[model samples]
Target: MDVYIRSVNVGRPRPGIEPRGRDTAIDKRPVASVEVRDPGPKRGGLGSGVVEDDVVARRHHGGSRQAVYAVAREELDWWAAEVGRDLHDGVFGENLTTVGLDVDAAVVGERWRVGTALLEVSGPRIPCATFAAWMGERGWVRRFTERGRTGAYLSVVQPGRISRGDPVEVVSRPAGGLTVPEVFRGLTGDLDLARRVLDAGILDDRDHATLERKVARRTPTDH
Candidate 1:
């Protein structure tokens, strides 16, 4: 629908992007150019990255499923109004800030063509302690969770260079798919919606396994 990349952000993270916080690569700043790396299908799955974006928390971040983090610029504007402060593009910890795209509503299996690269929607960004600390707002995690506008995490399907102003078009989407917001809420106590993600079959194995484990843990025992 004519979505375009608003800003390409990467991070040169230091030990202390924030005092008393994890060395998250979330403090992304705008970059003039970004060379998206897909690693090809034989290598496994999509992984998008610019030259400057570094991964400090390797254990929890930087995999095929969570390759690139994206948030719609409109959502950033919404947070700006709600928090009574001006929000900038990179301030939300997004690697690629998009304009005119409903990121939260994007289906998990959906693919987008950006520049010469192709990216697939893996899932939504689940808020964590690092994200909470970055915001520095009281009840930030709860608020963000309730909002359910969690940004999408993308996998590079076809690796190539991508930069700001690149046109984004949906290449394909799963049939009767669940949206990003649905998956986010499902992770956060919504069993019905969470189960739907399994049915979609487009999510990464790691994420799908996580949900499978959770469901197993909650299953009813024989009476």
Candidate 2:
């Protein structure tokens, strides 16, 4: 089966569930098409590489490395079945709802060409408190982390227009690189997996340092 975009989604700020009451863009809706480009970097940089997609929580979301987010339609269907609800595209705040892709298996630094844009897989989507509140399910964060299908985040390498049904072509993959699920486990406190990912050396400097600190803090004997 060919990998393709099932929907192109964007969102506007909505009333948030967080304690601080900051607005959130978790309620995304599908659009016919979207223009994608690098948003530079987080904090003082342009937000949401998908033009017009709101990234109100700029402190933790949106940046050059996280220019776009894609989640597999199959995963959504699975979650919908699990929760006994109809989970629609973009409901999880993904910019792209994809079909025929095992997003969790994608290696970090893998490149995909969708429509005219080139995107490099940068990391996995880490579930946040906003996501948990949005789901409104008990122990949603722990449940999601355990499932480990957190879809991939991409950095735009070449700007272009993307639309529903656009084919997602894997342009390249890093040899022996860590997959999205592996990275997600590491990020979610799997010290052993994190140490292995660090050995792979696919993460950028910032992420590398972050994981290093996390692992070091948990493994005192490593020092």
Q: What Cα-based lDDT does every candidate model obtain?
A: 0.79, 0.91
Error of 2 at 94 (Å): 0.3
Backbone clash count, each prediction separately: 0, 0
lDDT of 2 by residue, 104-219 (tens): 89999999999999999998998889999989999998899999999999999999999999999998998888899988888888899999988888676778899999998898
Q: Specify the poorest-scoring 10-residue window by lDDT in model 1.
A: 39-48
Error of 2 at 61 (Å): 0.9
lDDT of 1 by residue, 94-157 (tens): 8889999988889988999988889999888878777777788889989999999999988887
Clash pairs for candidate 1: none
Best by TM-score: 2
As a whole number from 0 to 100, the lDDT of residue 66 in candidate 1 is 73
**Reference-based TM-score of each model:** 0.89, 0.95
User: Which runs in model 1 stand beyond 4 Å of their true positions?
Assistant: 17-22, 39-48
